[model samples]
Target: MTTPIHITHVIVGLDVGGAERFLLRLIDAHRGNPQYAHRVISLTGKGTLGPQLEAQGIAVTALGMQSLRDTPRTYIRLKRALQAHRPDVLQCWMYYADLLGGLAGRRLGIKRILWGIRNSHFESGGTRLKRAVRRSCAIASRHLPWRIVCVADSALEVHARAGYDRSRMEVIHNGYDPETFTYSDTGRHRLRRELGIPPDSLVIGSLGRYSAAKDHHSFVQAADAAMRQRRGLYFMLVGRDLTRENQALARQIAATPHPERFLLLGQRSDVIDCLSAMDVFCLHSRTEGFPNALGEAMCAARPCITTDVGDARQLLGQGGRVVPAGDVPALTQAMIHMADLDATQLQAMGARARGRIADHYTMNHAVDRFESLYQTAMALPY
Candidate 1:
């Protein structure tokens, strides 16, 4: 038997974010595969998902990084961990990890190192330190790591403009597992019942963490406008920091014309069920690389509407609607138009959406591409 390719994944942390979730899915798909063995190293403490990974019998090491002041100590710790593991490849996720992990792997003389980029645009409200780290990664990109993997084509273009080496960059969209995210009548019925949504009503839902970029305020405005013009139009929102306790979000919801019709299911475990219950799913982010929730919703066979951000238009592709980002009026019109569609039209559109995913974005497709990339990278001379 061939020796397994050992991959040590390094990340800033294991927080419940897009990049973290993507890492989990990528590694989980490799279970029982003889060609690859994987472990994780978190620069910060073991976050919410670390224990979950450990539960699956995957090794997870945390360096307990607190702040930038601890860089020297953390760098030493990361280097020691890499030396002890002696992985064949060091895969770093996000900018900070790329900078730290690339240096460590190079110092240890590891020939194969890959950097993962998860966002197309810099955060509009990011901290100065984050901007500095991103600039540093761009400079390091010229030499560190054998390849850079982007989650979307838009990400590749954006990073190229930011001075990342376009020659070494590759695009690999996020893929979904149909069995885990497909439509289910049981899930739909149960979610509607649990949320007290009327059987005859139409629900337009959005799934993402509440933040400035996600533009939850704009979503609320659009939902409010759509609700004012039509009855039986409900809005469902699911993600962290989206609860009524968030004063700003709560105020927006309360000010909506039909407040009772809005469902704020903050950060749920049964996301598939929540998605299944939606008659339409929307991705309203002002920025993204490749959105997992949008794809998962499409996998659930929900008719989707997304802002023209990241690769959403490329992903949706004749499946559903696309509107300009931050345009509340445009989004409101799209929501109203979607709600006006009959059951047959909505169902047909949803089926097409899922079919597109099955054809182009299955987890198997992504895994195959990744495996092929790894094999090719290993064969290349240093």
Candidate 2:
């Protein structure tokens, strides 16, 4: 057998979140690529999905994070891992991974360095501290043979708007495969019974780590408003809290009125079933680059009512509705609209979201693009 070409992906963790899962699915899809075999390096502790990656014979390593905040040691630890693996190309996912991987790739003499930027709605301009964060890693990106890849156009635009060089950045839409995530009415019935959500109740759902950026609280606020408008409505929240920040938000959520009505299902395995339960899926994230949960909900054929952040408008196309990010009133109105929607109207709108995902977003498509990019990089003079 011919030897596989080497490409390493550095990420913060193997958590079952958007970017981590996306990388795993992409790696799984491209396993057959003769040009490069993939390795994943987790900068922090391994997440729940670590075992699955190992089971598939994918190499994964963790830095065993010692502190909550990033320090010089974090970069040094990542650099040691990079030196050992010595991959031909390095791809970093999320902010912490990007900064660390970029610095390590430069120090280790890696030929290609790619930073995946997924957050699209961060309008928090750089103060001295934020600028320091960007400046700390900007040198590695600019000086080395590096590229910044955004999963959505809005993400790419956000990077440029934040003074990142346009020429060095690219946008690639994450694809959705119906094979991995399919809509199931049968699953919906099963989940509704488990949660005691009436079959007739309008289900509004969002799935993500309880993070500030995800702005899940905004979704909760919208649900509160919707519940007032129409009593007995249901809302489901999936995914676990990973950090103190997200945990703080969850605590606040639980303390609110009718917390029981808001089902806080932490780190669920039956995502498809939960998606199935939602009649009208919503994500009121304050900012995003690409939202994996939003795509999954659409795949489940729910009428998507999302805040206009990330690549939602572009991705949703004409399939669903978009409101301004964090606008509780608008999100509330959208939720009420879903409450008012009959089965007929929902089916019509939802079919569009499902069709859009089936046609565009899929692991197969994303993997293909990545494979091609790797090939082009390998063919170039190093």
Candidate 3:
């Protein structure tokens, strides 16, 4: 019998988020690499990257499911996919992908499955149920011959504490393409004008889906304080479509002093353009594995001020601030300090962030690490 040759990547969705972006990068990096034949499976329907990948002549499949909880059916559909693909290695990302897809892959006799843990402990600690889900992941994960890959050290430690074998887990930082996100003077001015801000106005911005854990409220509070002391400084909150929480945040911002100065630019396609216009970047997320926006902004040479979450401190180093999560007062001070830095100091910090990626976290670096890991993991006798 021919040995089952399966090495398929499985993700939950293809939305315009960090993980989805990573999927695109992973595919593009390894598209022509001779080491393996690759395909992508999205449990949810095709995402924005679907056409892009298909354009590269890579195979893309979507299971057409609605919800992660839409199980048994999801399970059955996934079973069919596994049987058809018959992958030797199944890589599972995020929660639903890790649990359901990992189980399905194992049942289909995939030997070298790897679980991607992208969330942090703080977010997982919110309630008994979420913690229970984490436990379930730990339990379901143990029954299979698998390795765990986390995007940050915190996530690895969390998995280890949850009874995962420490030897089986490693931290692989996420990466971005400098070519795609480099800052341009023209792009900055154009984006600033588009947002109705003048060239001289200090633009402080944050990007990321405005989920509760992103802690955008703290950003509002920090920008509010900074604006009082420094006029003509503007704040833009990017990344979020129309949502009830967005409306609520708008109301909250409107009631604050200098309401008109605060802008919420929802779900931008030209994030690098937006970053180019910013004098300061911020992220107040309560938790994360590694923030793509923060890293991208850094790569774009924007000085960042963020709360300590996920791998922020390690990633930012002297390039940005890392305060305790939800500490509005500390966050405010960090914002002001970053904003008040001398030109030379600010430029130096931005340079530091830019160097971090080139050395350790660019897309090529991340893809190389993954490819090496895959090749090494596959060579093991099962």
Candidate 4:
């Protein structure tokens, strides 16, 4: 019998973001599969998801690098971890990890390396330091890893244009586990009650961290516009730093006619239940790789309205509406349009959304692809 391939994943941190959540799901898919074994290393502080991974018997290590100043220490620790494990494949997530991990893997004579790219665009906001780092990574992408697995086709294209090796790039869309994110009437009722939302009220929801790339301001503006056109509409915003304490978000809410109608639940562990409570899911991201929230909402049988970022339009296809990114007017119109749909039409749209996810983007399908890739990588001569 062939021995199980040990794969080490190096990531920036295990925060509760899309990439972090997706990594946990990927690790879960490999459990009990004798063909593969996994280990994780976090370059910064261990976040909430590390414990969950440890509970599953996966080893997770934190290098405890607080900032750029700690890069030398992080590299030393990562190299030692790699030398100890001597994994069959070293998989790096995000840019910083890819750069550091790839260098370490090469230094240790690891033959097969894979880099995961999770964002379509780098909106550096004119930070010279960030731009310099991105450029350095782009230059390294030309020769470092055996394969670059992009979570979206858009991400591949964007990076290719930015000088990454097109031949080495592979698109692997983020996967959704239907069993975990399925709709629940009870959950819907419970979340609505907890949030003080009327059972019959129309709810439009957006899930993403409060970042410039997420462009929550656009979502807030769209929600405001939609609420102006219709009464009894509620908006749900979920993610870290999305509370009333956020000055920018608070100002946006205060601009709305019915600030009381907005339900800013901030960050919650019950994401599935929160998704179930929504009448419509919205993604107004200015940039994305592949949106986990959009897929989760689809799996929860909620129709979505998303911007034309990453592979969102392809993911939605005919199942949901797509608008131009950062377009407040278009997003507002889409929100209003979805709000006006009759119960039957909305149900039909949601069914299509759910069907699309189940047919094309299940966790099993993603795991199969990943396993095949791993096998191929393992077969290559060291």
Candidate 5:
């Protein structure tokens, strides 16, 4: 019998962000498949998602790396782990992992090195160390990796212009599981009651961490404006650092006309149920790659409103609304328009949104692409 092709995934961490969540979904999709075997190595300690991966029967290793000073020690540990596994492929997620994993894999004479890029915008707001690592990755891209996988076409284009090896890059979008992210009236009402929101209120929800890139400030500003015009409107926000303890976010909510109408849910594990509770979902990020939240919400049969960032316009298509990033007026108008939409129209739009996900963005389709890519890489001459 032929041995299963072992693939080791290297990531910066296992936190509940887009790339990490997608990594879990990608690996979990392969459970019980005889064609591939997978393991994960986190440069930092196992984050929140580490135990979940272990529960799924995948092994996870954390190197406990905290700063640039740990590079030498981390490199030795990573090399030792790779030697133990002797994987056929090294799949590195994000910039840091790409550089570290690529160098380590090459040192061990591993030929099938695949680097994953998930960020579309890099000109604004990143640490100096992160910036330096990205620059280094660009220089090493020419020969270190056999292929580069980008989450969106926008990301591929952005990286290519930044001196990455354009010839080796390909785009593979993130996919959602319909079984996990589908619409549920029971979930909708349950979450509403839990948050002290009226059952009949029209909820406009957005999910993202509190950062300049997410532009929660603009989301709140627009929600505040729209709430003044519509009496039965509420906003539900879910993400890390979004609670009342976040003084800046709290102050923004307080300045709004009806602070009571804003519900802040910080870092939830029940994201699918949260998506089900929304009447309309919004993605207000100033920049993104593919936006897992918008697609997940659409999979839950919710009409969406998104800023023109990343591949959002392509993902949203005609299922919902699109406005310029950081345009408070445009976002406010879009919110008001969505609220003004009748139930039948809203339902029709939602059905279309869900249909799009089923047709083009299912987890099975994504997994098939990844498997095919792996097979192609394996067949290449070392």
Candidate 6:
């Protein structure tokens, strides 16, 4: 048998975000494949997903970088690790890792270097330091990696406008494992009961980190508006810093007439179960690359309502409603429309949503594309 190619992935961190979750799925896809071997290097502190990777017997190394002050040292350590590993291909995720990993791979004369970009829009509300770093990455990206892999076409367009080399870009939408995210009546009933929700109530769910970019405020506003028009409507939000203890989220909930109906589950492990319990899924992000949560919800056979951002409309594809970003009234109207749908209509929409995912967004399809990309990159003359 031919020897497998060693592919090393470098990322900013292994946090439980969209990019991180996709990385895990990608690694899992290559688990038993004899054509490729994988290793991961986390540039920052070890995150929750690191242990999960280790549990799968995947080698994961953390640089333990504290802040920008450690950049010089971190680069040296990363370069040294690359030297020792002598990987055939270097794949970097997110901006920080893209810059550092690209430089390190070049330093070692690695022929195949790929960068993964997972955001469509860069919000103005980010810190000055973050803005500067993104600018740097954009500048460096033009000359770095052999191929820049964007998770969404919207992301590719945005990056091209921001000075990234469009010639070197490839669009690969994020994918999901249908088996893991499939619908379950038992899961729906059990989770609803566990959350103290009545079986007869309609459940609306939004999943993403509590950030300005995610526009959780808009979700709360829309939910509040929808609730005022209809009773037996409940909103369940799951993500980091989405707990009732969060002052910002708490304020939003307090403004709602039925705050008790809002269930704030902060960073759950049972996301599939939570998704199954939802009658309708919503993504109100001001920006996105390709929302993994929205796709997962669709795979779980739930009707979705999302803002028209990134590739969300492409993902929805007549399966759900899409409103303008940050437009609370439009979002509220969509929610109300969903609430007004008959059970048969709702079920039909959910079926279509699941069909969309099953047709074009399977994890296996993503893995096949990536493997082909890897082989193509390796075949190129450096």
Candidate 1 vs candidate 3: which has greater TM-score? 1
Model 3 C-alpha RMSD vs. true structure (Å) is 2.7
lDDT of 1: 0.90
How many clashes (backbone N, Cα, C below 3 Å) per candidate?
A: 0, 8, 2, 0, 0, 0
Candidate 4: TM-score? Answer: 0.97
**Better model by TM-score: candidate 2 vs candidate 5:** 5
By lDDT, the best candidate is 5
Task: Note the Cα lDDT for every prediction shown.
Answer: 0.90, 0.78, 0.79, 0.90, 0.91, 0.90
Please list the Cα RMSD from the true structure of every candidate, rounded to 1 decimal place.
Answer: 1.4, 2.9, 2.7, 1.3, 1.2, 1.3
Models sorted by lDDT, best on top: 5, 1, 6, 4, 3, 2
Which scores higher on TM-score, 1 or 6? 6
In the predicted model 1, the residue pairs found to clash are none
Give the poorly placed runs of model 6, Cα more than 4 Å off: none
- In model 1, the number of clashes is 0
The 10-residue segment of model 1 with minimum total lDDT is 118-127
Cα lDDT tens digits for candidate 2, 1-382 = 7667688988888878888778877777765557568888888777887878888888888888765466577788788888877887888886667777877788777868888877774446445665566655544456654677889988777667666767888877787777768877788898889888876778788888766777877787788877877876888888786222456656755665666677767778888988888888887787777888888888878889888887888888877789998788999898898888789999999899888888888777787777777767777787
Off-target runs (Cα >4 Å) in candidate 3 are: 1-6, 122-130, 242-245
TM-score of each: 0.97, 0.91, 0.92, 0.97, 0.98, 0.97
Q: List pairs with backbone clashes in candidate 3.
A: 6-87, 6-88
Candidate 2: misplaced stretches above 4 Å? 32-34, 68-70, 121-131, 242-259
lDDT of 3 by residue, 34-122 (tens): 65666778888887778877898878888888854676787888888778877767888887788777888777777788888886673
**Local accuracy of candidate 5 as per-residue lDDT tens digits, 1-382:** 6678899999999988999999999998888888899999999989999999999899999998998899889989999999999899999999889999999999999989999999797656688887888999999999899999999999999999999999999999999888776887887788888888876789999988888899999999999999988889999999998899999989989998899888899999888789888899999999999999899989998999999998999988888999999999999999999999998999999888889999899988888889988999889887
Which structure is stronger by TM-score: 3 or 6? 6
Clashing pairs in 2: 118-289, 120-288, 120-289, 175-361, 175-362, 176-361, 176-362, 177-362
Candidate 6: 10-residue stretch with minimal lDDT: 121-130
